[model samples]
Target chain A: MDVYLPIAEVSVNAPLLLALGALVGFISGLFGIGGGFLMAPVLVFLGIPPAVAVASQANHVVASSTSSVLTYSKAGSVDYRMGGIMALGGAVGALFGVELFRLLRLLGQADLVVAVSYLLLLGSIGALTLKESLTTILARRRGEPARREPTRRPLWLYGLPFRVRFPRSGLYISAIPPLLLGVFAGILSAIMGVGGGFILVPAMVYILRMRAAVVVGTSLFQILITTAVTTVLQAGRNQTVDIVLSTLLMVGGVLGAQYGAKASARFRADEMRAALGLLILLVGLQMGLSLFLRPDDPFALAPGGAG
Target chain B: MMVPPGPPPMDPPALVAPAPEPPGPVVVTQTPTISAALTNSEIEVDSSYAGASLVLYGAVFNPGDDPVDVVLVVRGPERPVRLVRKVRVAGLWLNSRPVVFEGAPAFYVMASTRPLSEIAGFGVLRRMGVGLDHIQIDAPDEARTVNLYGVRDVVISRLGEDYLEWRRAVIRLKERDGLYRADPSGVRFVDPGLFRAEIVLPPEAPTGEYRTEVWLFQNGQAISVRRNTIQVRRVGVERWLHNFAFFQPWLYGLVSVLLAGFTGWAASRWFRRT
Candidate 1:
């Protein structure tokens, strides 16, 4: 069944919508990334108004992260102290990001901001991830052992107060890394309408040098808090949270995520990264092409931008 | 004096008896004479009715000897509301006196009562059918007439054994320079899952047979109403192209699928590690 939005006066195909949610969910589950980067572009391509699409993507992240967090907590992988500090910093960043978005919109530059941001971020991330994966694969093929280096905790972070010991990650790192990561995630989350899982996973593994086992759980915890706040903010301020659309997507995504997770375990880590990198590149190219192509006419009464 | 009176009375009585013999055999003759003839009246109308503009026309007929008055009535349901009303006749509004009324949803004609002798030459009383009812009045006597026109609120009455069933459908109308334009707008229920209703019209639709199918659904069971004709005609090239492009569903679906597949594939590849 299709549910219509009275305010937007738009009709969405429920099953197709759910499938989209599932695809995003699977990517998030497999890569330990919040699938927001993919969600915004897909929503626009599907003819959803850009503002509504971004807002709705943030809403979906709330659901996706909440579910993932529950699983992580059950496994005792979450760093509560670290997550708390990060969340506090993230809330501040989110508010600032939203204000910036509003300012850009007022200047009649929302579309330009969205397009530029997506192109720059996705292009850089895609190129970097592809390079790393290819280099790792080529190195492995040469039968040379991969180099492992211990990350040195910065002196300033250690000198700062609130030193936390995470037994699972086997580290006594300062709360500064998690805090900064949270703020960065929040800013990106607000702009991109994602839970910031994609950025968070890499930051934890490479920058913070957290154990692989703890990275997924820690990122999910941060995502849960950040996305929950984003959802409420979007609801209270913009009133863009659509319960019906979100529910339909969640129903499909939850099931699809389970299946994708099972399938992902069979693939090697490098293979998954390479696949994800290619996917991001393709989506970025499509978005770029849309700028030059004539857009399809939206058939609904009272389309966006009137307000 | 008595003898003179009796002579006079006798002379008068004799004359009176001769006169009273017969009241001139009362002649009751039945003549086969044409008292009145039913003359065919012509209905005339304008090119188009745009948003409550008055559609002007007249009914011309000759009533022999007897004076007759005509009453105009149109019938349709209150639902899917449309109202047509009468107004002043075109060109002769100042000189002619006419009756006006609220238009109805069905086919109706203008009639008037006047002596045939009074109707010298062509007696044309301009009539008006005005409203959103979209009732096209055919003026048979106009310089250019529309043979087939789009009709609104067409009630399809089903003749059942016990009770009558009625369903309302909009008729697509087109007309060209006094000719009938074939209508291709026919209703269809394309998607069963979504219960999406569509009206399909073809580009090459001519002044011929155009069937409409309205599927009635109750309790998830669909009953088909088939072979409903909506007359189409030549309204010119512009109208033909307009009708043709209205029902291109395949084009939309094709584009949607292609874009979706490409994006989905790209995203998967981009995010994947070697």
Candidate 2:
């Protein structure tokens, strides 16, 4: 069925949108990460305006992360002290990022900036994840135990001021690192319309040396807050958030995530990670190649700019 | 009143008659008059709206048997359009040199009984803005008025052919989007002087007042013209949401956030129960 989205001012197939949301949601749940990076780009490709796609998908992130965070909080896996500090930094960063996005839009460089950022970030991350996962898988196949990550914290983390103890994660570290990491995640979320969990989990594990048990939970908590803020800001300032579109995506995402989470228990971790890495790499490559390829039409038209 | 004649002949009179009659004294008759009306004056765009097609039925009142062609031009609301040209910059395509058209119609579709070229002379069609090529799209920065031999003439500076490229790009892009179109045989004559044309508004049609001009052409001249309007606006939930987003953006944002949070919480509870 076709439905006209009010804010985007376009008619789109409702079932198609729901299916897209469900597919992305399933991937996110299987990988234990928010799927904003995948959803936003797909929405753009499906004919939603770039800005609207970015903003509206942020709302979907909020719902998915909220549910995940609730489960984590119930299990007492979340580090509130750490997550709160990061969320604070994220809020400020998200506000700044939204304003910057608005300025880029006025300059007519928003789409270029978005595409370039996605190409670079996704390409690098995907390559690293694939290489690491493949190395582990090959080592296991050769009858060797999986290599462990180093537990030692970086020296600079100790050197920073404002040190605080996180009881849940059982860590004593300077608060600045988590705060800065949160700010980075917040900026990324606002610009790329993602929850930034993929980046945050690794950063927390390697940089802050937080416990693995609490890392995912804390990251989800931070993402929930930051994306909520981003959604509100994008809607208020840019008027690009389409609630109807978001709702359709959320309904499918919520159901799909549950099933995906159930299916994750049957799969090996390294293989799943490798598959996700390959998928991300392919998407990144496609977006990157589009910039170099000759366009069908060199001219584009948009309304609402000053004449 | 003269029995509203029958459906038009299949072939043009010129094709069937090879000989021309000797010139005779002109017999002046009643001036031709045209009237048109849309089947629906107001098109409500609800959530189910994909696109809309309206029937524009009209009639030309001419006493004599002089053949006349029907032409209809449907123009949607005017909007300021920014045209961007992508330039290859250091191996990556980037948008550069944006040209702004102050007032360009969001939707423009011209339908006629016969091809515009065959119905009228080039000058007549151009002057009447009968086809896509004749439509005026002006860029303020590239246009100026200068006095040539004591007579003021409005001249459009071409900016060395680059500006013209942007102007044509606007039409080309709009055409690709199905917003601007020209159909040579879109108008059908139900009876000799009665005609009907279908105006199809695509899903991307801008919502506002659409002006449709019906022109009656005879002997390469527009003898009669009639104008009508169509109002396209969002209705029901669509209108409410659009107005809320634009008028009370902050509140709407808050509502969106709250709704998202609630949905998340509800999903968690539902899954937990399951």
Candidate 3:
């Protein structure tokens, strides 16, 4: 059956969208990522306008992260104090990013900018993850100890003012770093149309030195707030959010995530990470190559001014 | 707004006193007349709407014994469209040289009993906008008005031949999406002086007012013409959602967030119990 999207003004196969959402959701659940990064690009490939795809997927992120945050809250793994500060910064950053997105959209460069940002960010992150995981797996197979980096806080991090305590994570750090991290993730979320969890998880682990148990929950908290802000701004200013499309995706994502979580238990951590890294690399590479490939039709059409 | 040239100005009122009537048998010739009506005047685009086929039945009167032909043209609402040509910039394809077409019809469909070329000459068809090739696509920003020779108010594009390429590109792309089409034999004569045509509106049809024109062709000239309108509108939940997003976007956004949050919460609760 076909479902017509009001905001996007496109009729798409309902089952196709549901399946796409499930596929992305399952991967995200297996790898413990937000999956917005995967969903946005695939939506564009399915012929949804890039702007609509980007904005609509942000709504999906809001739902998925909210669910994860609730689960984490139940287990008392969330550091609300830290997450609250980060969300404040993230909200402000999201406002700025949404305005920037609007400006790029008017200039007709939004598609290019979104595609290029995804390619660069995903490519580098995927390469690094793949290299790290491969090395760890090979070392274990050769009966060698996996290399580890010495844990040390940067001198500048301690010098910063406005120190705060996050009792749940057992960390007392300057609030400036966490706030800045949130702002960065928020900007990335708005521009790249992602939940920013892939970047946030590692940053929280290595930079903020937050405990692993608290990192995912706290990041989910930040994502829930940031993506919510982005979705509203995109809708109010750009009017690109398709509630119908987002609803379909959320339904599929939620269902798929449950099964994917169960399936994750069957795979080893290193092997799973390796698989995810390769998948991300391939998606990024495909997007990057399209930029240089000759298009079948050189003329592109838009409904409004100079687009 | 450019319109199909109307019937050559009704033979222009005679300026000089009419000459004394020549003595002869005054045989009155009947003028061909055409009228049409759509089966459904309004097409409602609900959630289940995929596409619609409209039946237009009409009749001809006083269509003298000159073997008259019927032609139907439907044009959807006009909107500004921009066509951008991608160019290689810094080793990447980027949009540039945008040509903006003002007042371009979002949908166009032409149907006739016979091939347009066989029914009328090129000049007549061009003047009447009877065929796909004759539909005027104006780009005001890229064009200028000038008087050429004795002709007044001729619009010419600044890009010269490049403008024609852009115009063709617009039609080509619109055709690919089934937005613009022409059928030489789409109109059928159900009976003497009675005719009907079927217009197929694809799922991507834009919502707005549509104008349908019926023309009576005789001796390779359009002797009679009639026009009617149809409306394509979003109805039911589709209309509500569209209006809500455009008019109350902030509230809609808030509602969207709340709905998603609730769904998420509910999903989590459901899984926990299992």
Compose the digit string of candidate 2's lDDT tens values, residues B1-274.
3634333322333222322222364333354556788999899999998889999998776765667888999998888676677789999998763455657888999999999988988987776677898776656655554443232342323355577677788889989989999999999999987899999999888899999888877777776677778999999999999999888988888898888888878988998998
- The sequence of per-residue lDDT tens digits that candidate 3 reaches over residues A178-287 is 89878977887788888787777767876777876787778888888988998998888878889999999988877776667568779987887788788878877877
In candidate 3, list every pair of residues with a backbone clash: none
Worst 10 residues of 3 chain B by lDDT: B11-20
Indicate which candidate wins on TM-score: 2
Report the candidate with higher TM-score, 1 versus 2: 2
Per-residue accuracy of model 1 over A1-307 as CA lDDT, tens digit each: 5544322224566678889999888887777666888878877676565656766566566556555555566668777766677787777777777666654543334554566666666766777777888888888889889855566755676777778887777778787778887887787777777777766776676677777777887787677677666655554445454444555565555555545655767998887888887877776666555444433321111111222
Local distance difference test values of all predictions, in order = 0.47, 0.80, 0.79
Residue A157, model 3, lDDT: 73
lDDT of 3 at A208: 77
**Candidate 2 lDDT score at position A168:** 84
How many backbone clashes can be found in candidate 1?
Answer: 42
Give RMSD (Å) of candidate 1 vs. truth. 24.4
- Candidate 3 local distance difference test against the native: 0.79
Better of 2 and 3 by lDDT: 2
Summarize candidate 2's per-residue lDDT along A1-307 as a digit string, tens digits.
9999998778999999999888887886677677898898789888788788888998888887777777778878789899999999889889988988876665556768777877887887788788888998999999998787777888998898998988888788888988888888888888889888777876786678787778877888898899899998998888989999999998888777666766876999789879878887777787777789888899876433422
Worst 10 residues of 1 chain B by lDDT: B92-101
